[model samples]
Target chain A: MKKVIGLWFALVAVALIGMSAVQTEPGLAVGDTAPDFTLRNIDGKMVSLADFPDAKGFIVTFTCNTCPYAVMYEDRLIELHQKMAAKGYPVIAIQPNDPEVQPGDSFEKMQERAKEKGFPFAYLLDEGQEIYPAYGASRTPHVFLLDKSRKVRYIGAIDDNPQDETGVTRRYVEEAVAAMEAGNEPELTFTKAIGCTIKTKKKG
Target chain B: MLKKAIRILGVVGALSLSTFLAAQEEGTPFPFTVYETYADFAPVMAQDNDTTYVINFWATWCKPCVEELPYFDSLHVNVAQKPVKVLLVSLDFRRDLTRKLVPFLAEHPLKPPVAVLLDGKYNDWIDKVSTEWDGAIPATVVYQGGKRIFHGEQFSSYSELTDLLAELKQ
Candidate 1:
């Protein structure tokens, strides 16, 4: 009986560890060192955060093709890139969804989307689905704004109104970029949005 | 003879109307409320006495969210005697209501009451729903009395949902 009870306790311990490991890690917060990554762009060129040394900061956004929330923000993301790139905070969109799970977000579809949308910024693919989890991206359209020092200054949504552009009360990304430009801390460093969960190659 | 025929037609119309009404009451199952903002939807999340509220956040576009809906419906019916209420909160875009949500609901007529959370500013309310919620769909929040439990994942089976509810009931 003593041996059986010990075995049961051991089983429970292993189960708890497994559950904790798979639980979504607490996402990166303001002032955390943003990890650098080199990923392939839609044009088949490798792009790295280090490549844009002259820029003030980077708007690292995880987004995909199939998600309705991502689709709704496509035009706005492009517009944001056009408006902010010149100011030295360019938007670097990354497709974090595993192509196996979301076929529409495959590399070829990304190329097609870039060509059709005339994207002003580089849209990269997190090839092995390794980069996003490190940043703790739980959903598509999750944004991590990093300063030139590669320190994550803000994390979360692009703005207040994802449904309607005209009704937008706050531009979270825009403000973060402006704050970085002015060498001042962003007023609101974090926000959240309802988006499609990021796809992993296999369920954990 | 004309009077008798008229009376027969009137009776038939009355019978059909009552039948239609009965089907409406049974088949219609649930009704939805539209919330234009997070503030507008907050009051519904309030804790009530002696009742367990099972609220599931979902969208029509999300496949997994649609897949596990039957479990909630099943629970709604199976737990009819228990003080439990199931609320299916749809995160579908306001524009897609008539085009997508309504039609989908018509086809899958859920037993649980449904609502469209029209809050455009998700940042304002995602945490309000649950601090642990990473804004993932198919997420569930259960409230029993004043205690609340949130699960930011889908229920793989009816038993999985029942198990969670059972825990909350205790």
Candidate 2:
């Protein structure tokens, strides 16, 4: 009887372990193919990577309303999205943070911020984290740049300066866009992205 | 009259400075122990005791780190029921440990289970925390049940907390 009970207990433990692996996968490395996904915009319209086929490149930035670092880059991202969209390179902003987890990162708050900023790009919701892991998003404002062929060419911080853009020595996203447009590879393609930790659902 | 005014200003400044230092001294929730280097704590981890540690690396100005403060507070409180421990290892400028970080954490009322990483070579220890880390803020490592789970995001929901604890319990 003791042995039988022990075996049953072990099976229960194993099943519990299996459930966790099904949950979340963070951290992606270089050369990863951009994961294609669809998310709703502030206007409640669906937007996906396929929406920007004619673009020379795409900027997939994971950001939210409350992160100061993200807020700092809001204008720049909007400007870049608009200026580059006309040039066939648009930015698709996604919020990977769970609205239920972070009150500030709610879809309503995201929409409010996007509308307030006059964001030209789509601020999509990465619900269920279907797209966050694919891009290896770790922080608010983490950026991934894809070339015309839809292959990831740059992944990292938006720029060298998160606090003050005036002192920025490098523009990783812009440089990547320039390289792709010039039919050349970006010289510097990545940086240590520093910002708010991505919000995730808690375990029961 | 001008000299008298100057003297009064100096006296006020000195008095406020002393009060600030006193407040800082009183704010420490844990018993005071000093370590000169990271190697000092290496043996504790090496011993692999039943102690579970949540080593967080954060800067003084990191936004997400500040936002997640309440979460870690609850985490520290919850895990205290077990043999678990949370170590808030600040990566803020070492020079600012006293002037900025300590005072900052003190002002914010960070309860015990916290310490500042005084090492200068961030490059060396950053990789030791997590390989996939791109030197981001709010990075945390859960050392529990003889395993370490490196988490790079701020967990805002209760499930994340329970999930981390559950993962550690395993």
Candidate 3:
């Protein structure tokens, strides 16, 4: 009877552990082929990487509406799109927060924000929060720059300065785009910054 | 009349300055050290000691970070028999040290020693903290005598944390 009870307890513990493990792969690194995704833009249109066939590359930035860090970079993102989209590198902003978790980042709010801000780029909603995990994006305002061949050339921040634009001495994304334009590899591939965690649906 | 006005202004300034310092002293309940650079903080991370260090990077504004802090506090208190050292590092901006961080600490007292990492140019030191870190907050790093493990997720329960600690020990 004692042996049976012990075995039952051990099995219960193992089952509980297995259920709680969240398997999240790390963010895609440089030289990796950027995964193509088709998400709904704020205009209620489905946008895919293949939609921009004539483009040189993409500035895939995982950002949201609620995060203060993301809010701070909103204008700069628009500026990046205006400056670089004509240069063949367009900014593709994706709202990665699960609506059930963060209501502020819901599709409705994203649409409102885009219309209010007059976003020059495609502000898409990653419905069900599936796309960010594939890209390994853990935070809002996390940037992944892909080249024309859909290869991830850079993965990190838009610049070293997150607080103040005037204080930005190193523009990481701009430099990366410039390098691709000149046929030279970007000097810095990966960088880090303090950002809000990408909101996901609460687990049972 | 000008001299008298100048004297009154000086007295008011001096009084307000003293009050500000007193508030700062009362705000922090734990042994809080402010590091202006990563060079000053690198030693704390690489401490090759017998005690297991439970280091959590957090901020006052982060909702999930604040939610999981009590677990670390409870771990600091309950794990008295074990040689554990809990360090709460505040990634709050330097300007918020007095305004937001100090007041938050005052409201919710934590048992672990806290520190403010006021280093700029985060790209330089984030990899040093953990290469796996995508610069997310509420990240925990458990280390003991060269054995280290990094988690970029919030600990929903104390058992989850203890499980990680036990795994790192092995």
Candidate 4:
């Protein structure tokens, strides 16, 4: 009886530990160092954050072709890159959706979309479904603004109004860059917006 | 000849009126009510009743959300005798009501009350709905009295959904 009770307690302890592990597995938070990665760009070139030696910071946007929320922000992303690239902060767009799950976000479609939109930034693919989980990006169009030291300064949406661009009240990404430029932390370090969940294969 | 022409006109008018009625019944906008702000839609999320409310946040563009929709419908039907309510809150763009959402509903035809919450300010209300949610679609909130549970992932099957409700009842 004593041995059986001990085994039951052991099983309960193991269950508790497993539950905690799953619960605490969250993406990188503010002040955490953004992991540098080498991903395939739409132009068939390998791109990395290290390539931009002179950049003050980066606007790392996790987006894909099929998500409507991502589509709504495509032109805005282009505009953001065009405006912010010269100011030492360039947008690094990464397609995080698995091609097998969402064929529209395949590398070929990504290249086609980039060429059609004339994207001024590096539109890369998160091959093998690796980088996004590391960054803890849960949805498409999720932004992670990193400073010169590759520290995550801000995380979340591009702006307040995702439905209509003209109706936007707060531009979160732009303001974060401006705050970094002024040698101060972003006033709003984090925000949220409704977005399509990042596509991934079901675990067996 | 004049009497014959008048009879033909009346027949034509009657046929057109029936066609119009059929069209109205077929394309009656899916009975979805649109809420422009989260504040306006807060009451639905915070109902203080004994009924178990299963509120799902979804959109037409979200593939997983669309896939799991029938599960919610099935749950609604399965629990018809119980004090449970299933509400589908679409995060679809307000502009897509005519172009996308309504048409999608016309094709799929879910058996639960569907509401369109077009509030763009997600940061403000995401925590209000469930602090555990990260503003992702296919998120479900099941509440009864004061106990609430939030699931941030999709239900793979109808049993998975019913199991959740069963847990909530416990």
Highest-scoring model, lDDT: 4
> What is the alpha-carbon RMSD of candidate 2 to the true structure?
10.7
Residue A146 CA error for candidate 1 (Å)?
A: 0.2
The order of the candidates by TM-score, greatest first, is 4, 1, 3, 2
Error of 1 at A128 (Å): 1.5
For model 2 chain A, give the 10-residue run with minimal summed lDDT: A23-32
User: Candidate 1, which segments miss by more than 4 Å at Cα?
Assistant: A1-26, A201-204, B1-31
Best by DockQ: 4
Against the true structure, candidate 2 reaches a TM-score of: 0.62
Classify candidate 2 by CAPRI docking class. acceptable
Q: Write the per-residue lDDT of candidate 4 for residues A1-204, one digit (tens) a residue.
A: 999999999999999999979877767899999999999999899999999999999999999999988999999999999999999899999999999999999999999999898999999999998999999999988999998889999999999988899999899999989988888989999998788899899977
**lDDT (Cα, tens digit) per residue for candidate 1, span B70-157:** 9999999998998888999999987887668766765566899999998777887888989989886879999876788898877778
TM-score of each: 0.84, 0.62, 0.83, 0.87
lDDT values of the candidates? 0.86, 0.72, 0.88, 0.89
The fraction of reference A/B contacts recovered in model 4 reads 0.82
TM-score of chain B of 3: 0.83
What DockQ does predicted model 4 obtain? 0.64
Candidates 2 and 4 compared: the better one by TM-score is 4
Question: B1-170 in candidate 2: lDDT tens per residue?
Answer: 99999798777656655666776588843222333455665543444777877777666677667777777778777767788776676655444566776556545656656665554333334565567676667787877546878877666765676687688776
lDDT of 4 at B140: 97
For residues B32-130, write the lDDT of model 4, one tens digit per residue.
788888899999988898899999999888889999998988888988998999999998877777668766766566899899998888899999999
Which segments of model 2 are wrong by more than 4 Å? Answer: A1-29, B1-18, B21-55, B59-104, B108-130, B140-170
